[model samples]
Target: MSDSEPRMIEILRILSAHDKPIGSKLIAVELREKGFNLGERAVRYHMQVLDEKGYTERKGYSGRVITELGRDKLEKGLVYDQVDFVYSKFEEMIYLTDFNYMTQKGNVVVNTSTIYDESSINILKKIIESGLSVSPYINLNEDKSEGKIEVTTLCGTTIDGILLNEGISSQPQYGGLLKIEDYKPIRFEELISYKKTSLTPLDAFSSPNRTSVLDVIETGDGIIPANFRLIPGVGRKRTLDIINKLDHIGIGGVIGISDEGRDILGIPVPEGMVGIAIVGGITPFRAVQENGEDIDIKIAEEIRNFNTLSPITTKITYHLKPVEHDIQPKISFLLSKSWNLIQQVNFDIEKRKGDIVANVSYLKRDDLDETLNIMESLYNDNPKYINPYYKVLDHPSDDDKVGIATICSLSIDGILINNGVICNPKYGGLLELTEPPLFIELISYNGSTVDPHKIFIAKDMTRITREAGSKKILASFKEIPYISRDYAVDLLDTLDKIGLSIYKISKPRELTYNAKADNYNFGIVAGSGLNSIAAVREKGIDIHVKAIEKLMPFEKMDRL
Candidate 1:
């Protein structure tokens, strides 16, 4: 916060960058090179001030080495200096990247982080397997200190170097948190333009409160550090070719490549330029830090021989078998949780702004029949969210008149409960219309006081149409105990035969098309019973919905 604080921080930073003590004369030279306009005497004066503050200590006849306090001060440095430091650091790294993918030779920029805990390394391996890092290749070495492990991961900007090697000009853009679902990229949830920030986006956003890299590895739903870059349109073809080559070598960090104007996730791109999202190289280490392990992260730490690093293999195997637990207590817990869900839906409906019923049962009087027709046509066309049941209400409100109650996905949990199995509904979100549909947004049922599905619907996020494989539809994510996977799958199959819908089910302890479940629980994705109503809303029709309105017997409801 002081005028001289930035300069002092810079002096500390320069000392910290070296492993040995540096003298005032050399410090003066470096300062002048950085446009500081400071001479040796002035540098000595600042060094004396720093020494008095116990930030630096002299070693023999050598100059000064930054102390632990000095390094801490550098970390909490001024934003102006930090930003300038990061930008210059990136420029230097880009200039240093000389690795050639063709011959697989030369130096490539890498990031190194020091971890003290040995157990947290497994978390890093899992993240790499999940493809949430810049590359699967890594180098691990013992630090000078005992019990410290130095992890080297390829920096995302290494791609910039590779591009430059092939004469392709590219610019690093923003570093941000990219949302991942079903182990695939959806969109960026947060971004900080590189030019505006002092810390690398990965370093700035990799905090435990900001990233869920561990959760993403296990459950496939979380935000991870990723960066955007722009390249000339003319180099797009060559750049992709290089990327493919990198992948063949077991190195991958590319999320998605966009065409000329804008990216698929709606990130902007300049004309005649292509934008790309790449997983940050240091992302996997967030798992270590998130687990409360102390780590020192160095972005663009140094260059390494491309051949020296080894491809990351599964070093620790996770036992995916189901654990034995008292099913009765879990059943009670799930039932209580489901009741809370019902209550939340009711509360949300009460506080809802418009004439929204906020459930799956009813629609407006005018669009009820038309929406039912659309649902029928949709089922006839694709057989998803197929419910033939409907009943007209004797008393219709101005908005909630037509009653077309489909079986809410929550009913699946009820069925699982009846069979003495535990099913916990986790999140409600928009499922992208893809070959293997991935959730693009999700809000946890337990964390939120409102119905997540209702919130997404009210925000106009639904884009479901009759056309296949391109938009998002209303869906819910749930997890059943791994032990109940077989019985639950059988129950889901039975419901599917009876016109109830279940979109996907994960393996005993694996992800369901990248959507993650609990630690030992398998994930199940089901179409929201509100799909039909949401589709009608997408048609520009004003409709009210009552999601999970009530639990009516299957036989009591009649076919339309």
Candidate 2:
């Protein structure tokens, strides 16, 4: 074929491979990889020739892409012979696997007119996925040697292979190439405000806003290295004083505002309004009152009369409005459609703190009661919320403290009780029974007989045998099956010999006292197998529970 004809074929191959417009720099790299060694001027000349031949079209300034005719030629294998010629020339030098070399040098160029082999197409897919520019080079041969694939860019930078695997297609422009005339500045006067009028039904008795505040307060109790601020106004001071009084009356400690509060709340306070901010945990909430002047005076009086301690107080000088535009007024169908398209642009942006929520699980009724009791006891003993409740979780940790109750099942090998007693004793001797008749059984394959009569005077045994020498154990106990104190002591001793551990006996009184709302049943349930409970509480709220139980005594269910 003639020189012009081959060049035209190469141009078609380039265009067909890339979905985006190609520049001279990129085109030259492709020609170089094809062993053409063409300069920018020569590539430009070839492109002009292709444009004249209706193989490709010029877009914007200095941008050229393949025409439909050029793509057709590639898809039909019309440019195969030309590609073969180019490949034959560069077979020894081109590295198919080393895509970085092409991307860095910007030598990986596309001529909207050339056809590409499947392997070349795969390489191009990788290059695009990496969000990196490919060098303008064409290689038709594949490299079999692993190290031969040195994926370096023209800038001499090595690229991670993972970058290439995540390639995505650039969003296509609409209306036959975007132009300045296609976009117009939005007219403020003509723009109609679209309001988000939808309202979620709020519970009458429980204020959603107040509940959110309480949640924030609970989260702030943890050892977070941040300051919390109270909003300006009389009600805030009064609320705080009440809380302080509650602390005096055996409630938890209150979080105080930090220096960061000024930074968060230094916005414009509306006429006859004051802003209060609390920033201990994650995000800050703003509270505004209709009468700031009057509220401030009332708060000062409350602080002086009620709270004799270092009352939480902070002074605010400047106030500002939230930086985020209230999008509720602009959320029209048209804007939503535009937003949907805008999101497709895939622009990188930062997210705000308010955009995220803490992944904390709500406390179960029984768990909540236990927590409250712990909190109340701490407050009563100290008259201050001094002892930060170290929440106990099911997982064992050295950092966990005693009485820091977690909503976890009593392991067959019971948790250590407050009285220094390992409730679920893996091995022990006779001792004073602190609570009551302890439940014991062999849930795993193990040996070491226990004399039930010696352990307890009135023994109600639930025994199962597993494979001898197995490590699993299952046992449970309730307070109802009362036994003599001496018998309990003997039982403990026998349990120590049998290699059985103790599981805590949950009391019913613990559950009933901590009911937050009326009609909620609070109790502990433990068993010896996979246990699941998903039931609705009295207030139409759902609770999910899961526990694992095991059978003891290796020989119980042998065959079947």
Candidate 3:
């Protein structure tokens, strides 16, 4: 109805006729050929206008596509004035031999790219559907050795040209006739060679069904008519089985199919056939050895042997240390004497492969009598020592009360207080010792004991000095001495000043009691008057069940 309406309709028609979205440049070319004056910019503007009105939509930056509204309008029919103008323009370009001819069918100008033939039109439609834009004519000039046929698209851009030939051996030259942009060139000689080796299929078959046939073609190695037989009733199951077997044998592909012996099975034309294909070449399997040499046979044999044997379950060994010190002198002595004592006490301990020897020595002197006599007197006279040492040792001390001094030693299983008094009242009295002592005993478990001869002693005087602060008499000798009362007193003084509490003492009776007991599980028996001298003697040490009752109140007496 408006002056621009007819032009807009014409633009819509051009776009609707294209198989793909048409670019503004192509639309401009179409308009130019129709004798209409329009530039690329003007065409682009009209396209945008159409798009805004919902008649067209932008496909990309360079192109536009017809929308549903444009299709509906085309079906309804064009106005008379627009139709006449389109037809007059089409008439100027129409040719008799050209397939794309313009004709008037009522008020519509019917311009078709196909000749007025059903087969030709159908072929054209198929080509378009296949995503190809074909030219209006085909050049068939046999005289021109390298005939040139140029084709321009509606967008005025030349895509690509093809070279036509009669036979497979023909070499394509520049610009013959066909326009094939997607296909790659293949020589007739190659195809013939493939055919000779049964590589090429005689007829096209679906990829899935033609697997065996294709395989035969590949492995034939340029040889022709290879022979092979397929088993009968070879449906999917048999086919798959055969394929797997063939693969294992280094054979591949299906060259030919036949039913040479299916009659014996009473079946006609077996479900699948045995076929002749080529045997594929194989590379021998190999492994690199530690010496970097390729080992094929050895590796294969090893793999075969490994596969034959049952898989072994790997096992790992773990050693758990004693969680709590039982305080039995023999067990504690063994454990403290050597680090390996804990390992030896395990019931499940394995015999070690090598010999384990322990070296031990004792530093003794008569001058230590003074320090030892004082410690012995404290144990005998102190009321705390009247009962048992452990009871006095286990009791808590007053906040401001500094504990007594003592001579102590490291046993295999635990610490040993030689001459000391329990000072903490809760355990009866805290222990005081003149110096750490040296003792020998076999490592033991709940009842079993090891050899005492295997015991080792290593004195850590620095650790003792650090533990016993500078308050006691022995703290003056910070460095350890191999002899004399100065060393003994210094060690005790260092221990007392360092705030180290007395843990346990060395008593031969504790070891003897554990050795004689049916079950070596003995609890500590100590009282407030904890005398270390009496505690060490076999008969003097009394079993104070009351201390056990007091220390382990929660523990069931029967359980103990």
Candidate 4:
């Protein structure tokens, strides 16, 4: 394969990343950003070659766009050139990843897979809980037309991205199956060097019959997919520190790491380099395949926000078994009884404590039961939107005279995420009621340990329920990527149909009411799910509210 082929592939990639045509001059600039030394003249030369091959087509003087053939060629380049292209692409994705571990924000790379049969979800859940997968977090969306469920998992490349952000350079070495004994990784049983394959090595090595991940989980002895990497010896301590930090934040994939000059598992390392092995995110898919279920997976598909994923358990919350009958009939009475409770305006602060206490007790006993029953009904209806934490709470906390759990506005982020939209929730604040609602107070979601909504409420920053017809209320603003505007619109509409609280969704590069969005992103304003809870707190009622509490299935939520 000629060296120029890889450069052409890069051009195609740049074109694919954008929906508009691009000229050679602009392409050269983008290439320079990627550290390529290509100049405008050099890019034009390549463009001519691509044009002759019909891989690219010139559009109305706007320059050239990659054609369908170009997309195919980019995806499957010259076989001999693939190894270099694959590894180079890995580095490029790392550079593209903007996820900041410190702020707990930005996008991390992920692997997206699809399973057609609904029955395999339970098996996948077992694999995830058994710790045979990369991260406990996952993203799932159903494709009704294709009758498939798409699953997204954290790619091992995310570690490299995080490491790069920390000023540490990591070199991807290979991907293979690592044997395990007594729950400890023993050695690599099979290996495919990243520098020698056009395909993602982990994806290449994964096979239903070839892997024994289920056995590993059950017997503590078997094989699972793993990736190998090398980092400068001096960075071992720092690397471990990063891994520790990731673990604390619920992001796990690094299975094992070796000391300087030592081998990882049974693989030898360079003299001054340490070897690191990462558990492959494809393991869950492999487990499903091993169970004779049909599945499709794309390894290291793209970069996405670290916060976008939910625990794998959330995906299986409602679909684990078949329903014997409709639950709507069973829950209809409860829904009727609690309809007013769900739709009640913020409580009156002037009410006596005894009266408030009685109301709280009634809401707790009746509303709570109705909420759980609604979630169950939802699980049977549409499990994807249910919150995962509701299963764990059986009763209100003793300290909290009133306990209320509302679906946070951040749940919109989750919805957008599942639909391939990377939504960054920028602020949780008081949105003043006016001709155009304006945010008077704002707190960033990044770098905050506590939910900003909770902090605002605790600080008494809201006047949502101070009056019977208060104009001001709590709300949140999120940034949606410009390219995914259409997807976000449709998904937001779906949320509205389901009765989720949404205030405004801005046009591309526009403000939503008064919430601002950058040129590259659109803004979304959603009423805080805790608006009711906040009103209760305004009354001096001892109510505890949790925002973005947990990933609960949509089915579990009953709209107030």
Give each model's whole-structure lDDT. 0.69, 0.27, 0.26, 0.66
lDDT (10s digit) by residue, model 3, range 1-560: 34565577778878877878889899999888756689999998888888888889887775888999888655332323322332233223222112111120111111111122223333322222221221222211122333321111110000000000111111111100111111311111100111111011111111111112112122311111111122333333444444344333222222222233222111123334432221110001000111122221110000011111121111211111111211212112122233342223221112212111211111122222332343355445433222111211222333322222121211111111122211111101111232331111111211111111111101111111123442111110011112232333443344323222223321222322111111222212121211222222212222221110111111111100
| TM-score, ranked from best to worst | 4, 1, 3, 2
Q: Using alpha carbons, what is the TM-score of model 1? A: 0.51
**Per-residue C-alpha lDDT of model 4 across residues 1-560, encoded as one tens digit per residue:** 34586688888889988789889889999999877899999999999999999999999889888999998767544433444567788988888877787888899899889999988888888877665666778888998997999988888788888899898999887777777766766677756566634446666555335578888877777888888899999998998898889876667666767778865565667799987888887888888888888888788878888887987663221111111121112111111332223232222222301100011111344345444454345334423322222222444444323344555565556555544668776666666665556665454443222444655665576776444443556777788888887877877776665545567888774546544676888888877666556555565554556544333344443343
Once fitted onto the true fold, the runs of candidate 3 whose alpha carbons sit more than 4 angstroms away are: 82-93, 96-560
Q: In candidate 2, what residue range of length 10 has the lowest lDDT sum?
A: 171-180
Best by TM-score: 4
**Cα RMSD (Å) between model 3 and the true structure?**
42.2
lDDT of 4: 0.66
- State candidate 4's TM-score: 0.52
**Considering lDDT, which of the candidate structures 3 and 4 is the better prediction for this target?**
4
Top candidate when judged by lDDT against the true structure: 1
Ranking by lDDT: 1, 4, 2, 3
The residue ranges of model 1 lying beyond 4 angstroms of the native Cα positions read 1-8, 37-54, 116-119, 143-146, 209-221, 287-298, 305-308, 314-560
Instruction: Give lDDT: candidate 1, residue 158.
Output: 86
- For each candidate in turn, give its C-alpha RMSD to the true structure in angstroms: 22.3, 32.9, 42.2, 23.1
- What value does the lDDT take at residue 362 in candidate 3? 15
C-alpha TM-score for every candidate: 0.51, 0.18, 0.19, 0.52
